[model samples]
Target: KLSKRYDCVVMEDLNMKGMSQALNFGKSVADNAWGMFTTFLRYKLEEQGKRLIKIDKWFPSSKTCSCCGQVKAELSLSERTFQCECGFTADRDHNASINIKREGLRLLA
Candidate 1:
């Protein structure tokens, strides 16, 4: 579905294993099979002549406001929503996704 709908997919190159060990959410993180999913998705995208762009893990997507471009100094994982002094607010993950996609496009360009 993704291959047909989009020519490119953007994502963060996260360290899930490190997160699992450090954060002590091994069961939850490992159960997601993110690595397998990523591998398969890459293969499928390649097969369909699509592309998958993975940005660096430390790109500060969540810490940067997607609307006003304000970069926060700190953003906790528990803070499910992102708020900026510029009056920009959005779900943290959603904002991050937008940033990731924009960065990916920039990389391609």
Candidate 2:
């Protein structure tokens, strides 16, 4: 249903180190499937005549505010949530995902 509605998918160049570090050993084993998921998603998207836009590694998707486009002074790995002065609030990961998607769209345009 979602695929039928959306024309494209976008993702960020995820920080493997951060992801790995955040997981417990047992969870890390499970998280190993992430790469496989990404590969499968890419092929599946192509088969559906859809494109995946991947944002660059250097793009500051996490630090940059998606709402007001303000840059935060600091954010740490321990921070699992984002609270911007502009009143933008989101889970840290979700915020990064949104920012990366925005950046990807900009790059595509």
Candidate 3:
């Protein structure tokens, strides 16, 4: 469905093994089947001549201000809101998503 609907798909190349090892919810992370899902998505996209771009896991998607391009040195997991010095504030996830989308487009260009 994704391959047919979209010309390109962008995803983060997460370090699942490292995360599972570091976190207490190892079983939950392993059970989420992210690796399997990405593998299947890759194959399906290739079969349909669609593109799948995986951004680096280390990319500071959540730390950078989406509006001003300023990167913060530290952002704790407990901080659900992303507040930048430039006065741009947004939900952390939403801000990260915007950054990811911009990076994906940059890569495509």
lDDT of 2 by residue, 34-107 (tens): 67877877777788998777777777888888889898878987988888998989998888888887887887
Model 3 worst lDDT window (10 residues): 22-31
Model 1, 1-81: lDDT tens per residue?
887888999999989989999999978997899999989989999999999999999999999999988899988889999
User: How far does residue 108 in candidate 1 sit from its true spot (Å)?
Assistant: 1.1
In candidate 1, list every pair of residues with a backbone clash: none
Clash pairs for candidate 2: none
Off by over 4 Å in 1: none
Give the candidate order by descending TM-score: 3, 1, 2
Which pairs clash in model 3? none
Overall lDDT per candidate, in order of appearance? 0.92, 0.78, 0.92
Report how far off residue 22 is in candidate 2 (Å): 8.2
**On lDDT, who's better, 1 or 2?**
1
What tens-digit string does per-residue lDDT give for candidate 3 at 70-109?
9999999899999999999999999999999899999999
User: What's the CA error at residue 60 for candidate 3, in Å?
Assistant: 0.2
